[model samples]
Target: MRAAELHGQRHVVVNVVDDVPPPKPDEVKIRIGAVALNHIDVWSWRGMAFAKRELPIILGAEAAGEVVDVGDAVEDLFRGDTVAIYGARTCGTCAPCREGRDNFCEGPQAMYGFHIDGFLRTHVNVPARIAVKAPKGLDVMAAACAPITFGTVEHMLFDNAGLKAGETVLVHAGGSGIGTAAIQLAKAVGATVITTVGTAEKAKKAAALGADHVINYREERVEGRVRKITGRRGVDVVFEHVGPATWEGSIMSLKRGGRLVTCGSTTGVAQSTNLYLLFQQQLRLIGSFGCRMQNMRDVMEKMAKGLVAPTIDTVIRLDEIEKGLARLEARDVFGKIVVAL
Candidate 1:
């Protein structure tokens, strides 16, 4: 088997590995087909991980694979079934896990691709409980994106933010993978989407993705454009993930009593918010992390029907992961970069 391992900061090397062991009674052996690159992969490649982890760790967080073998206890998933592996290592016995809110698991959790070996290998063992089956007609490339790309947006907009159909939303970095998903999802729900992009090309693409308004943050003031587009009323929700660089503007873009949901902070994380505005506006600030496994299932079902799809920037060979990471780190990709295994 072949695997991509991170031995040090900004270093990823391809290495040939021995055969994988058989699956445990509660696990399934998977032959990975595609890996979707996310900002977490870039963070790990840049050694930005806050926790302690061993080097030479396999480095992929989102992926789709075929079941080559299923343990005796795993009856629902069978051999040859395609599935999406959940990104986190959650304890099924915990209260949150039992409630389908796996992201809020009280047990100590280590995220794959950051704190543990990930799915960037030819073969990996997945817990059957966490492997959500992909719809029959969907391809691996699209199914691979369900875990992080689309599922995060589904959890943020619908679950935490409780966004309604008639409201307006401001999505930051509309060119990024999750950003593109946010715009499309908000549009599907009949919301007016206002997004910020860094370049003219991204702005044009964002508009094509059903964004009602696009702001070139590099050339124009983002908050001003958002306010004007909303007719000085401000937006009802802010789909924020860019972190501290855009935090203040995201706050300013939202209407009074509006909701702000965030998942990732690609930029520096520490940012100060005004106490006065928070009290006066009665705004709601919510911090969202990873999505539950059910979120992936819902995302894949939508992909099968073409309701929502990943905006693929390009597909690269397995060994070309470094190129993908570099592209994501530079904020140059307009959409997702998928690795074909």
Candidate 2:
């Protein structure tokens, strides 16, 4: 088996091992097909695991693979089934997990490619519950982006923000992996999408993805453009993941009683808040983490139907993953970078 192990900051070594374990009673042995790169992978590469973790951890979080072996207790999955592996390790029996709120599980949670060994290897054993089977005929590369990329957007826009049809949404970083997914998903629900991009090229691509309006944040005041686009009103929802750099503007772009849902802090974390404006406007701020297991299924189904698909910026072999991480860290990618295993 071949695996990419991170020993320290910017140190990734691909190792070959002779021994690999089989699946447990409730687990499955997966032959990883493709691994999608996320900002979380960049954070891990930079030695930014916020929690305590041991060194030399495998370095992939979002991936899809073929099931080579299934545990005796796992009847839903079978040999040769293609599935997207969830990044977080949550106790399936926890109240939140049972209630379809897997991200809020009370048990000890560990994120793959961060706190624990990930799927950047030839094979891995994972709990069957976290392995979401992709719809038949969906390409493995596209399925690789579902667990985190599309699922996170699905959870953020619909579950956390309660985004509805006939509404307007401001999605920051519109050229990003999740941002591109947000634009398509929001539009599929009939929402008017306004997105922010850093470059004119990204602005064109964002608009092509069905964004009603695209703002080049580097060239103009985002909040000012957003207000003008809305005719001095504001958007019904704001899909925010870029951190403090855009935090204040994201707040100002939202309408009264509107929702702001955030999932990541790619930029620096802390930012000042206006409590008076928040209270007066009755705005809702939602802090969303990972998605429910069901969100992964929903996105995969959408992918199968050709309603949405991943925007793959590049594909490289596992040994070349460092280049992808560098691109993600530099904000040089338009969508996902997948590693063919």
Candidate 3:
């Protein structure tokens, strides 16, 4: 089996290994079909990990594969079943995990491709509990995106922020992976979407993805454009991920009682907020992390039903992982960059 590993800062190499092992009693052996690139991949490549980790780690976080061999204890999965993997290693015995809020697990967690080995290889053993099987005939590349790309948006907008139909939402960085998913999910529920992009090309793409309005942040102010689009009433929710660069603007683009849900900080963290507006308007600022396994199941079901799909920028071979990460870091992609394994 072959694997893509990060040897050092800004150094990625593909290595051939012959020591692949079989699945444990609670795990399954998966033959990876595809992997999706995210900002986390870029951060890891750039040595921006939040925790201390050793070098020469596998370099992928979002992926999907075929179950070639199921453990004896895993009755829910079988050989040749397509499954999307949950990257966070959570302790299933925790209170939050028992309550179906796996993202809030109290036990120590380590993210794949960051603190532990990831799914960039041709074959890897995964815990059956974290592997969510996709619907029959669903695209493997699209399933690879379910764990993070679509699941994260589902958690941020619907689970945490409680986005409802007929509401107006402002999605920042509509050209991003999660941003594109947010637009589609918000529209699927009959919400009016207003998105922000960096280029006119991205603005047009965002509008075509069912956004009611698209604002080029480089040309116009997002808060002003959102206010104008909503007729000065502001939107009901703000799907925020871009960090300090768009934090204040995201808050200003919201309605008096609107909700702002954020999951990432691609533009760097640590931004100030207006305390007066937060109290006077009674705005809710929600910080969201990863999604639960149920979120991945919902996203795959939605994909199977044709409600929403991944907006793939391009598909590259495993050896091209470095290029994909570079594009993500440069913010030069309109959607996900998938690596066909």
Candidate 4:
């Protein structure tokens, strides 16, 4: 079997391992089919990780695969079933995990490609508890983005922010992977979507993706545009991910008593906020990460039903992963970059 391992910053090696290992009593042996790249992969490759991790870690966070073998205890999943593997290693016995709030694991914090070996390899065994069955109509490439790209938006918009139909939302970096997901999902529910992009090309694509209003942040101020588009008022919800660089604008784009949900801090983490505005507006700021197990199933159902679609920018071979990662870091992509195993 072959696996791409990250030894240090800007270093990735394709190494041939011994034979494939068998699954444990509660695990499933998965032959990974496709892997999706996220900012987390770029962060690890650039030595921006803030957690404790050993070297030579397999570097993929989101992926989908087929069941080559199932453990004796695995009952629901079987051989030849295509499934989306969850990205985190959470304690299933915890209160949150048992209650389906998987992102709020009460046990040790572990994420694939960050805390432990990931699914970038040809063969790997994972606990059957975390494997989600891909819907019948979703393909490997689209399923690969569900675990993170779509699931994150599902949890952030519905669970945390409670975005509703007829509402208005401001999605930052609307041309990015999660940004594209946020825009489509909001629009699918009849919400008016306002999105930000860096280029006119992306702005045009975002409009085609059902964005009601597109703002080129590089050419104009995001807050000013949001206010003008909303007729001097602000949006009911703000879908935020770009941090620090657009933090103030995100805060200013919200209506009174609006909700702002964030899942990433791509630019920088340390930033300032105004206390007076925080209390005066009665705004809700939510910090979200990952998603519930049900969120994956929900996203897959939406994909299968054609209510929402995966916005894949390109597909690359396994060895071309480094090039894909470089493009992701350069912000040269409009949607997701999937690497076929």
Candidate with the greatest lDDT versus the true structure: 2
Model 1 off-target regions past 4 Å? none
For model 1, residues 2-67, the per-residue Cα lDDT tens digits are: 999999998899999876899999999999999999999988898975757889899999999999
lDDT of 3: 0.91
Residue-level lDDT tens digits of model 2 in 1-341: 99999989999999996546788999999999999999989999999847568998999999999999988899899999999999999888878889989899898769999988998999999999999999999989999999999999999999889999999999999999999999999999899999999998998888888989999998999999999999989999999999999999999998999999999989898999899999999999999998988999999999999888899889999899888899999989888899999
C-alpha lDDT of all candidate models, in order: 0.91, 0.92, 0.91, 0.92
Relative to the true structure, candidate 3 reaches a TM of 0.98
User: What TM-scores do the predictions have?
Assistant: 0.98, 0.98, 0.98, 0.98
Tens-digit per-residue lDDT, 162-247, candidate 4: 99999999999998999999999999888999999999999999999999999999999999989999997899999989899999
Model 2: lDDT of residue 338 = 93
- State the displacement of the C-alpha of residue 308, model 4, in Å, after optimal TM-score superposition: 1.0
User: Candidate 4 — which residues are off by over 4 angstroms?
Assistant: none
Off by over 4 Å in 2: none
Clashes of each: 0, 0, 0, 0
